[model samples]
Target: MDTQKIPSPTLTLPKSLTGIQGLDEITGGGIPKGRPTLVCGSAGCGKTLFAMEFLVHGAMLYDEPGVFFAFEETEKDLAINVVSLGYDLDKLVAEKKIVLDHIHIERKEIEETGEYDLEGLFIRLNYAIDSIGAKRVVLDTIETLFSGLPNPLILRSELRRLFRWLKEKGVTAIVTGERGEGTLTRQGLEEYVSDCVIVLDHRVTEQSSTRRLRIVKYRGSTHGTNEYPFIIEENGFSVLPITSIGLDHTVLSERISSGIPRLDTMLDNKGYYRGSIVLVSGTAGVGKSSLAACFSDAACARGEQVLYFALEESPQQIMRNMRSIGIDLDQWEKRGLLMFHAKRPTFYGLESYLTAMHKAVNDFKPRVVVIDPLSSFIIGTNQFEAKSMIMRMVDFLKINPITVFMTHLTTGVNDFTGIDISSLIDTWLLLRDIEIGGERNRGMYILKSRGMAHSNQIREFRLTEHGVELLDVYVGPEGVLTGSSRITKEAQEKAGQLLRSQEIENKQLALERKRKAINAQIDFLKAEFDAEEVETLNDIELNKLRENLLLQDRIDMARNRKGDIITNKNSINKARGNIAKS
Candidate 1:
């Protein structure tokens, strides 16, 4: 049978790269080229910052000079504001790569008239664009430009003309606006006249704030519609588009160590597959962090970079604690192979956390990532939201093919992560406290490991001064034993075996003595028989001598012993016959 493969569409619309992290990917390349894109949001929602970044990126990175026509802030104020975000607008202007123009409209000096038009503003913008040969333009807060005009008909006409003039100038532009109550923009016309519309949102839930971005409309292009989380920091605007990731990331057959050799033995004797998501879950104080540290130490020893996110403990605290278990994380930190980012879960919202992590991972470019006690993310959010955030993180890390070792704190003996992210996990290890004989001991078991033959037996987990150790738990008729119970059971079996051996030795010794006594009795009987045979032979000899002497005397008396000797046999027979007849 022949297989058929469908080819993907090759046609795509012309777009100018935004140069902002993760934003271009969501927009399917970027905003429409040689056209205006409307970015609207409420106060302090990073609308102006987004526009400034677009212009600055075009000037500095893409070699496309830009013009910033600001109506809200002056040129000096714009330069000062963006300087903190690492954008040297003054330098770009000095280099003739950017032109900043401040257009101030005094509403008190304006009167509504039919002769009103944006022709004057266009001439000034046209001069600025031509002076620098700019390919990008940013009109921050376009509402102020027409705020003086109270006539709605003229405002709409001027908005369309302004967008059309930007396209005619062949420049990609961003128009910032204040979010309206019922519409996307305050004037409710910018969204319709622009080629693409992006909405920025700043939301606060439970006293925690997060910034999100959404592409409301993209004309003549395909774009991501999901509400993506974004963050503004010293480095600039970063958006984490969760929907931009897919399950098509490649899987690796290569395996990496879990840091604990015995634990690796339980995991098909090779360890976790590289790029796989490994979840280590246990109740409180079950060495979850310790296990994570071991993995970090092992990765750093192999000269691979590791990013550790500690939500509960501080970096110093984690390092000090790990030192108690013979895992020196400080050494790896000094070697620059390990980094610890410690923060509280409440320090940021779920989306903010995801965005920050996304940025850190991208910047560090580490091969291994460790998130200690992932359950802390569940403290302020629901299970669904937490799982969603974690799923996005997992997808992002997998795309980088980084080995992930995440620790989770469970409330009970069960391995449920509370976020229900087991399906996304490639390997799940459960650590539990086994209580027997009035003592508690740690036990580890591989709950599930996809695509590997893992051991199902529970191993007694020990945290020695050296490292983590996994020993075989005693499984017998009495039940699974561990700790002192296992040792005691082993001692009992040894004693029983020794007793059986001693019994066999004693029986063999008694049988040997009994055989020796029987031999001694047979020797005594043979000696007695020998003495009796000697005496019987002596008596027969003496009787023979007496008979011979008596015959000699009879021969001397009778005329010669020779005649008696010749006839001795016949005479003896005749005498015996005569005696019988008498």
Candidate 2:
């Protein structure tokens, strides 16, 4: 007998911060505890948002109160700005859970009378921490001190001292700075907050604006060093960290219909998969919204909650307009099945809209979400932000397993404007208005449906009072029709052909019936002639028989004239030959 010993497995753990929604999963957790993290970026790169979200989530979710020292905007302005984002900055202030100090470092407010240090900043910061008993602190745009103070050397030294002091105070701090060429911050603030450095960038590419965040350095813990897309929303900000986690790969098994039976049929069986993103892009006046509302209504009819985010129209206007097309969204709202949130995209920043959406999704817990038109969001943001927002929104929906339907505005009647969101969607439905023979007709087609077989045919659709109804596909000698003119021409040709065929069929049947009657009459006449043959020897009798036979032949001739006479002519010739032989 022998005994064996098994070796123990070794474990490696990552220490980090996870307070910001999906960020912790990316950073392995929150930033390394008690380290001064540097967040540097150009203006509007979301540096403040990144820092604020960390602190807000820390206080609200993890029970860690925080302090925010603003170097630019006042405390009141910051509170008001973040209020619409679903962040209760005022309440957090009232509860002493957060301390917001608007440090106005105006050049005129301070005098360069004598040699001094940033002892005033130290006192203010200490008072704030003592008042709130905070664990997290954020100095938004700490580089402002460099611009306000007179001595660069003293400012540099004081910055280094501030970092040391924060570490000694045992507060996990984030110091924001403006980005400079070839350096982390404009004044090289990264030299002091060197424990961890993050850079946020907002750039315009091909007219599209995008915001990206990257962790340039994380001192002790392992962290993702890639630039991630983040958004500022009504609830504050959300960073979409790219990771290998399965949280964004959830598969939804449920299916929802698109309201129109034909459209649903085009999608295979019924409709798209739950959690799938459906993009409906088309030129102007193609019934895109009508189609979207129809789908939303269908989901609501099935007892599923539906949230409609209408960016192009007001909620009341949308309800009124949809009524003309037979979509009673107000009724659905009354039944507690549908909710409509409509606002102008230019009314707020992209982050605010996203936060509103987040709130709507959270509060409504809808199974189906619809954005009447996503193109409007592009107005405030550049192409990059548009893409990032769309991607983040899609990811958010995927994780929740909610079906999302979005509409996009395109140019030209027949031409697609070509927005580059197709790659991120699960199904793309293109609606086009085709001009045919001075008339406009709408056509719909499923451009792509991932993981499912869909109809490749472009189907004809019409907006009616009952909603969008898909008609049979346009068929003609030249194949399927597109645009307005082609559809009209094909429809006309089809109607003409159908009419001609029907008329010919009717005439042929009438002639056939008449021909049979005439044949029967001739046979009876022949039988009479045969029966009376012996009695017809006299002139009078012969004359009567001849006249009667002539009359019978005339009736047969009349019947042949009504239709194709070839068959009747051959029969008549054979009969005459028989009579002559007899």
Candidate whose lDDT is highest: 1
Cα lDDT of model 1 by residue, 283-314, tens digit? 98888888999999999999999999998899
How far out, in Å, is residue 479 in model 2? 2.2
Pick out the ten consecutive residues of candidate 1 with the lowest summed lDDT: 1-10
TM-score of each model, in listed order? 0.74, 0.63
Model 1 segments more than 4 A misplaced: 1-11, 109-114, 150-152, 245-256, 272-277, 297-308, 314-341, 348-369, 382-403, 423-426, 435-439, 448-453, 476-480, 484-582
Each prediction's Cα lDDT score?
0.86, 0.79
Candidate 1 — number of clashing residue pairs? Answer: 0
TM-score of 1: 0.74
- Tell me, what's the RMSD of every candidate? 10.8, 17.2
